[model samples]
Target: MTELTERIERLAIQDGTIITAYHALSFVRSSDVSEPVPAVYKPSLCVIAQGAKQVLLGPESYFYDPGSYLVASVHLPITGQVIDASPEKPYLSLQLQFEMDQILDIIQQPYFTENTGHKSHRALVIGQMSNSLHEAILRLIRLLDTPEDLPALAPYAVREILYRMLQTEQGNTIRNFALLGSRAQRIVPVIEQINREYTEPMRVDNLAKAAGMSTSSFFSCFKEVTAMTPLQYQKRLRLTEARRLLLATMSDATSVAYQVGYESATQFNREYARLFGQPPIRDVRRFLGMNPQ
Candidate 1:
């Protein structure tokens, strides 16, 4: 634990998600309690080395600290807040983004054996961090200091971490993520399509056909994996991107609405207020500290 803390502290010199030489590994440090921040959580492994945090996915709230880590296997729109932190202790964490192809590579390995079948759930899972995994993470972080060693050794360290993850209880989720023709695997393409085309009109039949599943089956499977219906999932994606554009560009409400696939400004205002607790303009102002109320 001391080694992990020291290494993370050394690596996380700044107060946000700091990208490393290894694109898959990043570090996070926050010094204060955070307001509810909505984000699209990509598939990744997040480990907390200090403090704690809570992530709200749809209606579900997940909490994790140093003892546990969070694994998000799919893209999810979520509200994340640092529930436990202060100036002195702060919140320190790291995230490793894994690609589906990497998982497939592991699956194809001759020695790898599938273990523990898991039912579809919210695409997110919390699992305890074992000492072995922790040591692997430490080694990966240590490689940051040796630039020449990184290109040769980092991949093996990352692979070792993934292999260790396979030995954990949530391994099945990881397996299903890469297994060809599996229900979970089938939904991956649909997620990618929706993310790429969230601004366009979407039909369940079209999406289901794209996934090679019947309408009813697609609806059920999508809900099982994402914890939301197809429409709801698309809406979340749209709304999340809308919020981003609003904050980043400060574009007008109506334009941002259409930009994110909403045809009616009135409808956009209504839904934006519902999801963000305020209209677009006011939300932006509040976020920017121009209008505190």
Candidate 2:
């Protein structure tokens, strides 16, 4: 095994995810390949030290392993699956969450220069991992060994990691998302609005106005970044939330259908089945069988 994987496996002795001493950083390990699980990915950097994984956003699929890193520049609902893992090696990885302010801070430095006027790119991107970036990540992980040093040095290591990312080919995409008034940045507020009121009825024209763009321009930019139309994105949000609610509460399929804003039970069942590959009640029962309370 490589040093990076070994370090992660050692730190994350148990399976599942753990929030490390550094609050923004977390480690994850799984012993076997997993099923597609839906989740909302925050703005963060995901590096896999051992095995490969796949992330599905809309119809697009992204796969990454030790040689690459994945970045989610905005909130996106996605399906993630571990395509590779074994009992002996397991799947070792770490995710470091950061805010737009952090990216803006790095861009303000004189050494960094990029044209921020570029049009929006996909919010999810994969970049080739360089030796410098790998070393920076290793240094950050090594801090767990010296908990006391984390306070003084963790921030610097994290800063270096972000700086290295800014130097990559996809750096322009990342920069534009953080730059004020950039098309990508302008779409962020609208994304936030959808996330907050996903259950509410959506008005495309109103959302476009909120982003200060015409309907066509807004629609194009939004799809360019998210890989889905506004209505499709809202449907994803609704279905994902419905799955969570069904598992969390005793609510039946019909109740959850309306709870997530579906006007007709028939439409909810059809869409939910389309997204999850099964009817709501059957899927919930299968999930319960696999994981019993």
Of the candidates shown, which would achieve the greatest lDDT relative to the real structure? 2
What would the TM-scores of all predictions be? 0.95, 0.93
TM-score of 2: 0.93
Global CA lDDT computed for model 2: 0.91
Candidate 2, clashing residue pairs? none
Worst 10 residues of 2 by lDDT: 111-120
Q: 176-276 in candidate 2: lDDT tens per residue?
A: 89989999999998999999999999999999999999999999999999999999999999999999999999599999999999999999999999999
lDDT (Cα, tens digit) per residue for candidate 1, span 88-119: 88788999988888788997899998877464
How does model 1 fare in lDDT? 0.86
Q: In candidate 1, residue 97 scores what lDDT?
A: 88
